[model samples]
Target: MKRVAILGGGPAGAFAAEQLASAGWQAVLFDEKLAWEKPCGGGLTYKAYSHYPFLLENSTPKRFVTETVLAAPRAGAVSLQLDQPLLIYSRFDLNRLLLDRAERAGAQIEQARVLEITRQGSRWRVLTNHGSADADFCIVATGARNPLREVGTQLTACDTMSALGYYVPGEQSMIDIQFLPRLEGYIWIFPRCSHLSVGICGKGEPAGALRKRLEQYMTEREIPWKHGSFYSHLLPSLHTASWRRNRVTGEGWLAVGDAAGLVDPITGEGLYYAIRSADLAVRALLSEVTGLAEKMNLYQRLLRRDFAGDLEFGSRLARRVFHGRFLWASVPARMVQFTRSSPRFSAIMRDLFAGRQSYLDLRQRLLKNLNGSLYEMWMSLGFRRLVPRKAA
Candidate 1:
């Protein structure tokens, strides 16, 4: 039987294993912890649920979420009450679901840290703490690099975007995204059944900075939720410039998910992109006619075509909105009013939230609005001039 080795037990690796197993390939998965809880906001957008049905249909902890309350740090907070429901589950629960599915699909689950990986002739050898294993193909699914750095790969680390996540005792079912005035990151409150998952990310420079920001946000909001009980992780942004070198695949091995730097820069959402990329990897592996290197290149091309514009656009917009306290406090109201009134404006916000649309989508909408509503644009321009400009 043809064998495929997948590293990491995160969404990407598990998804890849499930995909490959469905394709009749024997998949072996490795990770340090099988039920380890990784730090994430634990909120999935509506589009994410639509894309991954298994999240709701066959997952542990069950799916719970339907509304999102978006708030900006500014005085005139623009609120977007989403009509569609979102998916919110524990990362531990979700990971277990995906991993279980992969295992059921015939992927062997192994809990071991990968020490190193090397190419051996036509096959790939993976060195793990448990021992070494060889496979016809290897997939690097490691969420983030640890001590083991793959050869011919540039392991570039960015300033870690720290996040604090934990479940609080509460009675709520909606998700909240609060833009904090003093911090670069916003506070998130996602409730599931009986407990509230609240935390904050960004703005915290050092490791412990997130805790301080969370304390201030909770205290200022008069929220009675206690702190000192939460999980934190470094949310790494994708190194956009290194996509080519990252090469989703090599001679006999490939990479997926955060291993391939597939995280969406703006939203810190990786499940969608991770699964999407894994699908591409499975396609390459399954196509008997395609060479592995060619398949790798194809995955890169698909990523560029599938998500390039949206990622870049989101990053640029995030910088504008998240760079300073001023815009965080004021811009949301302006955007909410415009979005609610104009279908064209709504499309722009949709593009921003869901990566399906391009940056040009917003640009086109703005230009169209400018052509038809010169007075509205002029008023916006006037308001911009009225505000004290500060560096974002």
Candidate 2:
């Protein structure tokens, strides 16, 4: 039996272990904390659940949010009714669920921290604090803070975003997304089953600045964030050049999830990419490719064909979407306004929220519908002018 060592127990590692073990491969997964919370929204889009039905059919405690409110610096807010609701889960719960699935699939789950990984000819020797293990292959899924420097994406300071937030003891029916001025990222309030994950993520900005912005927003909205638990983490937001040279696989090893920097630069969405990359990695390893080099190439090709190319394009657009000026206003402000005034634009936004829209064709879609959107906005303004004013 071929032994596969997975150096993480997050969604990506756990999912890979499940697939490999089920295929009769001996899979061993190692993680210091098998299940833990993260400073993220932990929301899964329609594309995720549609691709993996088990995500939707599971008995896990989750929140299905169908409404989202988008706010910008001067655009106020616009309520959008989602055609496909977002499935929100606590990271700890989600990780536990994936880990449980791997265990049930015959994977050996070890609660240990990986100290180092050494290459021993065609095999790998994984050194953990608890013990040592040998494997025919290695899968790196230790997230953005991967301790194994020899494997995974080489992330520089510019290739990451600081994500920090509070798990507030509150509840709401809708998700709130607030776009700030001059920031490369946005703030989000995602309501889980029991609490709200109110967080801020920004690139090229200090964590202290991000936290202050989040606190001010919370204070203005009276969210009482001081009473909530604070958490912060790094999110991979690879630049265009970084994507071109991203090292996902080499020798007898492959990296998945954040370790591979398979994250959406614009939306800060990683869960879908994490799971999707793991699936592709396992498929490539189990393929009929005769050589290790061929298998690694296959994995790279699979990722590019699946979503890496799209994410790379998204990296180019991230700055424009956040900081660019549109129609004499900030891009985010214009987006909210367009969503309110134009039905065509609103539909596009809905598709984006559901993950049905791809960044590769976003410009074409917007350009194709720009005329209709403008006409709708003009007509909406004219209709409002025609309506009689309410009596004081």
Best by lDDT: 2
- Candidate RMSDs in Å, in order, are 5.5, 1.0
Candidate 2, after superposition: displacement of residue 144 in Å?
Answer: 0.7
Candidate 2: what lDDT? 0.95
Query: Where does candidate 1 stray beyond 4 Å?
Result: 151-160, 182-184, 224-228, 239-247, 324-333, 336-356, 369-392
lDDT of 2 by residue, 159-203 (tens): 999999999999999999999988999999999999899999999
Model 1: how far residue 163 lies from native, Å: 2.2
- Identify the candidate with maximal TM-score: 2
Model 2 worst lDDT run, 10 consecutive residues: 33-42
